[model samples]
Target: MIRAVGAAIGVVLAIVLASAAWVAVVSSGRVHDVADAPDAPVVIVLGSQVRDGKPMKFLSGRLDAAIEVYDSGRAQAILVSGDAHGRSGNEIAAMTEYLVDAGVDRDKIVGDDYGLDTFDTCARASDTFGVSKALIVSQGLHVSRAVALCRDAGIDAHGIDAECECNWLAVVRNYAREWLARPKAVLDLLSGRPPAVVTPPDGTLTAVSRG
Candidate 1:
């Protein structure tokens, strides 16, 4: 009986800790424009899963929002960060294609296919490319975490409101999952090499240069 009681307590503690970690970084005020403030070398587009090189609905939403921000003169350049596990299955590539389709200049889009995870993506931006201040585009629920992660990595970052919660159920589920993801993000800051500047190679997402 005592063992069972201890197990239950452990479970509850884990959940509580996760929830607190998530709440510590979230805020309704984080949604803002990175443009018209200061010039940032790059705008890091966070990764989301793709389907056969195509963006899933959620992923598309982020791309669409980022495109709008791009069009509005918010940022001069875009960096698509995502998994490049497959030669053809690349989220950043899909995102670049989407942006180009929406009339964004091809030269402004940069792809960072090495960002396999959120922390890696942000760190790569700060360390790999010398991005100090950047606008992270994602769903409202996710932007806070992105901003927090960027700050943790010693980069000045802010979030722009890119996703809406039309479906409360999905939003709640994302929030729930984020609770646990926050701690891992914290750990990422504690581990890794120092930041370094990397210049992005020039290439269009679907083979067309905006220039």
Candidate 2:
């Protein structure tokens, strides 16, 4: 019995390693610096924690990157995806307010309040928002997984690493979280689970001016 359990553990560990490797391989050459990122119809800013109606540090970095993309004209619209029902405050509202305060046109922004996770964000962008091609913005440790998941969800997706002032300890913690999350992301793709909330394409994204 001990030998059988040990062998099963080995198999699980191998599978986890393989999944992480797959994400890295598939996302190679797809993550670019802000200057090199390709133009796309929209830039998707994945959500993070909100504090007192403002984005926390990591999420602020993501918003800042999206702002840069918007200013460069590489993306015509911005999609802020996050949980509206967050315990602290409404993440979607906070994200939108941040962008508007940064001078992005309110009309050019759309909100997905049910983007509860990375996979759900990608899936909803494809199915509910009618986004075909997009640049995903996230922190360095998380952007590759976001890019891979978005691509698997049928978006012609690329990624930009958001800048953050993270301490070494925070960085290490985030990397550990990412390592464990990759296998779950792989399972999510293979399982083909639909997002928790599904709505018809509301034409909001399509209506944004591309010029």
* Residue pairs in candidate 1 whose N, alpha carbon or C atoms collide under 3 angstroms: 106-210, 127-196
- Candidate 2 residues lying further than 4 Å off, grouped into runs, are 1-5, 209-211
Write candidate 2's Cα lDDT for 97-157 as tens digits. Answer: 9999999999999999999999999999999988889999998759999999999999999
Question: How many residue pairs clash per model?
Answer: 2, 0
- Return model 2's CA RMSD, one decimal: 1.5
Candidate 1 ranges beyond 4 A from true positions: 1-29, 33-41, 86-88, 164-169, 191-211
What global local distance difference test value does model 2 have? 0.92
At residue 78, what lDDT does model 2 achieve?
96
lDDT of each: 0.68, 0.92
